[model samples]
Target: MSPFNNTTFTHAVFLLTGIPGKEDVYLWITIPFCLVYVISILGNSLILFVIKTDSSLHEPMFIFLSMLAVADLGLSIATIPTILGVFLFNSREIGVNGCFAQLFFIHFSQFTESSVLLFMAFDRLVAISNPLRYTSILTLPRIAIMGLVCVLRGFALILPLPLLLKRYRYCQDNVLSHSYCLHQEVMKLACADITVNNIYGLAISILTMGLDSLLIFISYVMILKTVLSIASREECLKALKTCGSHLCIVLLFYSPEISLSVTHRFMHSSSHLLQIILGYIYMLVPPLMNPIVYSVQSTHLRVRLIRLFVK
Candidate 1:
């Protein structure tokens, strides 16, 4: 009756491993994971709280930020349970449907974050390119619709994954490299042919993450061009200044991901621990760092935070 019973495909389970080569150090590993969870939750919660309570912070820029905060929180929530289970409780077994749900949520959040970053880039471009028209253009209704689109895009793109995975049976040891379930990771363990799953997975990555990253890069290029055209050097700095946090966030989100992808492709021969470390960086670092980046860059947020804590 165990989920890991080999006789039943429906009951198949994937064993979630926290870190491949560091099992003995799970107790110590839990410390960093705990820190990441608290920071991601509290930092993002503060962002939501500050933006929500202040009328002045209700612009498109901050509104998009709130959206990003929600996505970050969701990403953290998706991975935290299994991570804690592995590190604290030694719970590794995840049933078929549980794995599917985890995989879906993880990918969905990643895609949502990518889409939000792309939109945030557009937000910066519009704010800098034409400040006068920014407010009128990105109205509450428009922002709401955009947020909805982000949610739907994440769901629609990843909805097929569980179904695709279900059609195949997994007979391998069903051990995953990390504490979280990823679509590609689970698909690789399938005993059946996964050509369709592989193609679809790659296609979705290209269409979502790849396309979004490309457009974000283009948006920034245009933004930098406009910033450079300002007559006053101060004005140019001011223009670029608004994008400082966003620029850092874009790099924070994409660069590690790109590095990890390249490593997986060209450097598979490298250390497994290195890959796990990269994966940790890819998942946990952004949520950990985003709030710090924003608060450091924005005087308004920092002042507001100070006032909040002063009381």
Candidate 2:
């Protein structure tokens, strides 16, 4: 045996999985999975490119939309490699450090997306509630600052997680539940004390995801109130239409996440396949759907995309 044969407290290898017990069918399963990843990447990339090249798209609303696209792209990129690795090549082995890093980025991108949604909510609210001050309130520098703050908020909350896990002992059965690393999923495998980890994870989850969702709801409530206060029905429809794509994107992103959280918490008797599929839905759906929703709903984006293709 070599000198590094023993499993120490510091480092170990983890076997990342793809639908437990269906490993043999993973390649066959990779087909749809690959398609989703490709569409997400291409769609989001196109959104970013459209925003970049069009001068009319440089305003706050479009800027925030581009931010969402970037976050979605990050999310897809972070999770796809390992997912494809598991499904296409049957490569499931990942180092402890690699797992921890993936965990950070996965949560970071998630938190960033949540933050972007929150910002987008505020953008819609400001544009509707105080149209005159909207430009004054959300200038380019301010939007950039808000984006950076969102990234930092995610990094700060999630950074300590991997460090906390590093202190624990993962001495046995080092198989991760999904193709990627998740905080709660990986935490359950730890043989060491995990009370603190559980507490912190719960607190951050509620603070980040819970708080963001609550704020988004409040923003929409206010938005509806503002929209309803309009005198003409036609004008009201026209105004609300601006938010249609954003609303769909929000629902697409959050609904599956809520289901996954519930499955992890209360669905103890749920099938492994169900849980895994829910996890996949949470990871794969939003990025793939957001751009399609925008492309369909926003005439400006649709026309611009058509122009790009024609050119």
Candidate 3:
């Protein structure tokens, strides 16, 4: 009823739940997350190294892959620290400002990662559809510009989020359900009306993520038609093989995100732990799996990774 009903508290306790085991359960979570973090860093670093050192990998696809690795690394680094802190220190208290900062970085990295994937899709479309001009089209300067554009797009998309949070009076519940402050979670705590925030958040998602997904889908559809028109089965197989890893990654990334959004909206508290686990999976699993996907499915990158490690 009151406009400032929940504005009394300056800070709130953020909850960190979902440890399956007993008191020492954090050890299990920490160990696995640490391993994943290490693997992600090493894997992505190797990709970056291979792309930098190997002149043969100086093509557009590898360039985009390297950027994707960097984005994944940033995503992992942004979220893992707080998660580890919650498990290690058994403390879930994050200041409102800190929460907002974490939320910003997480969303920023997420959007950047999505942008990179969209660019990768375009890169593939060019490689398959216009092989002759692929290099000219996706040259280093152009690639750099694409990367810059992706970053700027992410920043521009999420810039209003923190500002919107600034207008909110957090009186409902200061403690976020998950380890980090998610956008919806923070918005839910606001004492002020959240109609604008929700609308803006949905709009941003539709513009960036929804639009990106639609474009990727269209690109792949065009790619499929082109592949089908090819006369040779082997050539078609090879083309599909080239896109296999990317396809896998895209499915993995988007499916859970869509489900999480839906579940969080309707199911809400029914699957809080499930939501937290999915959040961790969405953030960490892609990074962990990306290297494997590239190494197993990509011959050039795999060889480069092997050689770099050997050296």
Best by lDDT: 2
Per-residue lDDT of candidate 3, residues 197-300 (tens digit) = 89989888888888999999999999999999999999999998889999998988888887777777778666667877777777788888887898899998
Q: Show where candidate 3 strays beyond 4 Å.
A: 1-24
Alpha-carbon local distance difference test for all models: 0.88, 0.89, 0.82
Colliding residue pairs in candidate 2 = none
Show where candidate 2 strays beyond 4 Å: 1-6, 9-11
lDDT tens digits, residue span 245-270, model 1: 99899999998887876776568698
Model 2: lDDT equals: 0.89
Residue-by-residue lDDT tens digits, candidate 2, 1-311: 32113677445778888888787787789899999999999999999999999999899888888988998998999998799999888898888888899998889899999999999999999999999999999999999999999989999999999999888777657777799999888888777779999899989989999999999999999999999999999989988998988899889888989888888877888887888888999999999999999899988889999999999
* Model 1 residue 131 distance off true place after TM-score fit, in angstroms: 1.2
Write down the TM-score of every candidate: 0.96, 0.95, 0.93
**Deviation from native of the Cα of residue 181 in model 1, angstroms:** 0.5
Ranking by lDDT: 2, 1, 3
**Top-down TM-score ranking:** 1, 2, 3
